[model samples]
Target: MAAESRSRILIIGVTGNLGFELAKASTAASHPTFGLVRDSAFSDPNKLQKIQNLSNHGVQIIKGSLQEEDGLIEALKQVDVVICAVASAQVLDQKLLISAIKRAGCIKRFFPSEFGGDPDRTRVSNLDHGFYSTKAEIRRLVEAEGIPYTYISCNFFASFLLPSLIQPGLQTLPRDKVNIFGDGNVKGVFVEESEVAAFTISAVDDPRTLNKVLYLRPPGNTLTMNEIVDIWEQKVGKHLVRNYISEEELLQKIHETPYPENMQMVFIYSVFVKGDQTYFDIASSNGVEGTQLYPLIKYTTVSEILGGML
Candidate 1:
């Protein structure tokens, strides 16, 4: 496809982790890329740096927020593809953006903020901190509005969860102990955020991915918690004590904890204990494996990620 003929992508939440990467990939793919960012994002030093990065990469900046429907509709009018990479807190907020997309009626494809497990398959209720339910709601709205959409079900983020050895809050690799959910053998698919972004951007212009879910399940990246710990152990040259959080115990934690913490526990149980990411057959569903779709893309594996951490 000619550069100018490529889909013009407008990524909401460009300052965010995945959103910025999507911007990078979109531009790299010769797509006329745009970013829908709030004016306030320029004030935060961290966000400003990202915004500056986007600007340097030739991403046309659209000064608009989802809250401002008028400005959002105007931004939507300028782009053919709208990808929302907003944080979990703002998943429901996409309803407004959806309304605006309907009003603008120019977007060829809409990628909602669902760069995680497929809510329809994962099956979580109230204890989930409203993460899956809210995303599922947005999907319904997208379909109801008859908006062309692609759902990126790129399960667990390796950078976020693997660094701490799957320990929820810890930011670094554990030295003495790590919590192993269940038998430490329930597998999950973990793709680094940037790779997820790249695969997502690749699907923007794909007809097969239109109104279908793109599952980022690289066979090499599919791993269990025990396998991850084994990799860390080999890197550190020492074995860490395994603190097993059984399914029963995990459910107890989810029920006992409060708000966000409770929500975290719910995810731990869902991903690790229940094995939601790998338990389903993507081929049977309305989805295609990202690696299968784009085998040429060099996806980072868990070992490569852990090796770099050291």
Candidate 2:
């Protein structure tokens, strides 16, 4: 534990959900944690409050921007590991970070901003989704630079999907009706955000996970959309009218949706409907299962999430 604590950890985009959770977990584990915040974050009340909260929790703030190479290099000099939790759209900005890491020459481990589906298997020629493509590019850059790194392919975030599904949102799953894409039998692993953070922090110093893709599929967390809805119905003691959207309709949406968010959703829906999220099996000998590695870590399953929905 003392040796682990000696690892000075730094997280980019700490204002974001994953980054904040990772910072909190790192601090709780007695690791010397540092968070990078943009100078503009100090002006925004919400971001400022979050920064204060992180500070109160013992995270030192390194004020800078990804665009500024000099500032980034200076910041990198203070930490041994760099965990990037930046948004999908801002993933390309990691080029600047990669450059700084090479220049600083001190970071022992680099965890790129890949917290979603595996990009290697999800590529569609016409789709050109920057979310996945940009992440792939970053991976190439990290490898090209010969940086010691770990890429975490944490599948879908269960907490993120729960609210988006239950509440009145883009992909609405109302109390009385739920939308099912394709055959709805495709299984995908959905991990909670905090669990992803916990497992990630735990793996930072573990030599076994170095330069590997750490998968976050817990034992019971894998389930299809239909299976998830079924669990919800069993928990609520009420059935939801299932509405199936055919593959043709989803493909049309992907082509016609003008809004970037909606287009992204269509791409995501295609992934889930096609079962691309489960392309890699975490139980395989080559895979690093989070819960198995850290026996005491409790992963939140879809059943538990559905039961908590009110």
Candidate 3:
């Protein structure tokens, strides 16, 4: 195993939120970084701008896709590591990626698109959730192919969960009220996106993380929903009306929700309200302390995130 700086890194789905940040971090580390984008992504103004930004930062843009085997294999042949940051909806498509990686035979490390909770420890009943199930499938595929890989169980992304719990695009606390799933007592790990990216890049060639599930549970970032709300209240100096959605009600919604976005909400309810995300103890013998690996990186806490939003 070699340091990530010495490895040629290719990040798939570089136009995405996590992928974009990862490409930036990889380039910052002076790794020869390449970003994989679909040929069509260049046509859209927003995606094109993101691609251009990565290009400006010295990321070589490779125009190909997981679906296009020949082009993907050719793109992968130049890299030692491949990090897939594809969206949840696109998780199943990684099968094509796995095939390409095997065909390329040059990739020494492969990171699948799992930057959330530990799917291995998730209960079988909840495994059917598209988000977790697809991730599980990809993990199995990666293992079956014997690809040297790292699986990151980053819990929740603070940027996503904070705004998502209330409303998308609303970066502040709810004005008058907020929904509290269950009793808000269940604790879950939350990691900042940039920190996750930094850790992933650092772990790219770290032997300890190879073929291991890297859990991103920095002590400061692990808190229950109640604690998060209290911190928010303290930061804004206002008590929001707490509307509690019981476990029973959320389970019913999980069963009944038809819309994809609402179904995603149901999945969130499954994770937070039902306590599915915190099933594993990261401090236990099974977990790897992420902060211990890179002591210099000051991981962001909920309060810091809230303060920045204010």
In terms of lDDT, the best-performing candidate is 1
Candidate ranking (TM-score, best to worst): 1, 2, 3
Compared with the true structure, what per-residue lDDT tens digits does model 3 show for residues 1-310? Answer: 3444489999999999999999999988888999999989999999999999999999999988888999989999889999999998899999998999998899999999999877776653452446677788898899999999888888789877675443323555676778778888877667889899999988887888888878887877777778888888887788888888887876676567655546556545656666666765665625576788888878988778877877
RMSD (Cα, Å) of candidate 1?
1.4
Off by over 4 Å in 3: 1-5, 124-129, 164-172, 283-287
Candidate 1 lDDT by residue in tens digits, 163-272: 77778778888988988999988888889888998899889989989999999988878888899899889988999998887888888777777777666567778888
Query: Which digits, one per residue and each the tens of the lDDT, describe model 2 over residues 1-310?
Result: 6855568999998898899899999998889999999989999998898899999999999899899999999999999999999998899999999999999999999999999777776745356556678898999999999999988888878766665452214453467878777888877787889889999999999998998878777768877778778887887788989888787887777777665646555545646666776765554624576777887888877888766765
- Model 1: residue 164 alpha-carbon error in angstroms: 0.7
Better of 1 and 3 by lDDT: 1
**What CA RMSD would candidate 3 show?**
2.6
Quantify all predictions' global Cα lDDT against the true fold: 0.88, 0.82, 0.81
How do the predictions measure up, each by TM-score? Answer: 0.96, 0.92, 0.90
| TM-score, candidate number 2 | 0.92
